[model samples]
Target: MSIWWSLHLRREAASVPLARRLLLGTMETAGVDPDISFDLSVALSEACANAVEHGGDERAGVSSSAEYRVTAYLDGETCRIEVTDSGPGFPVVRGRRGALRSVHSTAEDGRGLGLIEQLADHVHYRNRPGRGAVVSFDKILKWREGALLKVS
Candidate 1:
């Protein structure tokens, strides 16, 4: 079965893990290989964290009205993932970060794009029709028994 998933959530700390867990669980049930599922989940988590950190106003003590839109699909041997945010569009340089910059580094506050660049076969960012932007990535799945890889 083809693996496809999507989630929309407010810009809240609690919602981030909840969304990721739900999507990961769905991907697992959809027969997605574990490694692919894990990578996609990591990418989505970073995207959501960026949105919440930069676009949300959590100081209000209530959930931020901001929303994140995420979609992932596997067609044929290609897997595509998209994460969109309803906040102010990110800066142009935001997508230019290279993989050499590690997100896990203690000094880096913006490493989501870098991680995406390193993990995905292809990555792009563009403004959505509204007041937001969408980041998309693609990779070719090998369809191994335990992991997704590029087909020969």
Candidate 2:
């Protein structure tokens, strides 16, 4: 079975937990391995936190009601999530292989992206043309032996 859900949340601290809880509940109901679910949930929380903190485009006269979109998809043996915001898109700097961005140990911010990369099997950071930033990630899922929503 496949499941999909989306939420339009105001860019606020409280919304972070709301999104994370929904994801955890969904994964729990689907019998995802506890460790795997926990990892994904952490990654999701980081993404949501980033959006809530930097998702506002005030320079562009965007509304005070800053908002972001969180979408989750569970299909087959994988789970994917995407968080999009309406802030000014981040710059793109490519390294030899891909964007070479490093977060320092003393950094108070920017650690979330690195944490997300570590937690998820695959992670993507990009900007929506003429819109804002998008952080999308996915992980290969491991289910409990008696998973209630096992996919064929």
Candidate 3:
């Protein structure tokens, strides 16, 4: 059974907790491991927070976006989450291995993204071409005994 959900939310601070609660509720109902649930929820919150804070701005005398999007998918043994915003997009940076590296600054914001890296199995950061930035991540799921996704 695959579970998926999406939210188009106003870019407000309150939206962070709202997204987190929904993800947590879904995780609980699916009997996901508490630790994993916590990690995912934290990651979701950080992504949402970034969207709320930096997802939009007054550019070229234009008004900023009032909203952003969050999506989640749970299939088989993996759970994927994405937060997309209409902000300027991620700063371009490459690591020694030629992979996109998270912001490596002392700012708290950078740490939040770095935290997401520490918690998730795989993550993708990209832009939507015409005008948006997307931060998508996934984790390997571990089910509790009575998990809805559990196979006997």
TM-score rank order: 3, 2, 1
TM-score of each model, in listed order: 0.70, 0.90, 0.91
- What digit string (tens of lDDT, one per residue) describes model 1 on residues 57-142? 34433443467777878766777878777655555443255322233445467577778777778887776543566778887654
Q: Which one is best on TM-score?
A: 3
User: Could you tell which candidate, 2 or 3, scores higher by TM-score?
Assistant: 3
| Candidate 2 structure quality by residue, lDDT tens digits, 58-93 | 886757438899999998899999999998766666
Please, what is the whole-model Cα lDDT of each candidate in the order they appear? Answer: 0.66, 0.88, 0.88
Give the range where candidate 3 is weakest over 10 consecutive residues by summed lDDT: 56-65
| Candidate 1 local distance difference test against the native | 0.66
Cα lDDT tens digits, model 3, 25-107, are: 99889988989999999999999998888888557233557889999998888899999998888887888877567886686
Q: Show model 3 residue runs off by greater than 4 Å.
A: 60-64, 97-99
Give the distance in Å from residue 144's predicted Cα in candidate 2 to where it truly belongs: 1.0
Once fitted onto the true fold, the runs of candidate 1 whose alpha carbons sit more than 4 angstroms away are 1-3, 56-65, 94-107, 144-152
lDDT score of model 2?
Answer: 0.88
Q: How far does residue 13 in candidate 2 sit from its true spot (Å)?
A: 0.5
Ranked by lDDT from best down, the candidates are 2, 3, 1
Mind sharing the TM-score for model 3? 0.91
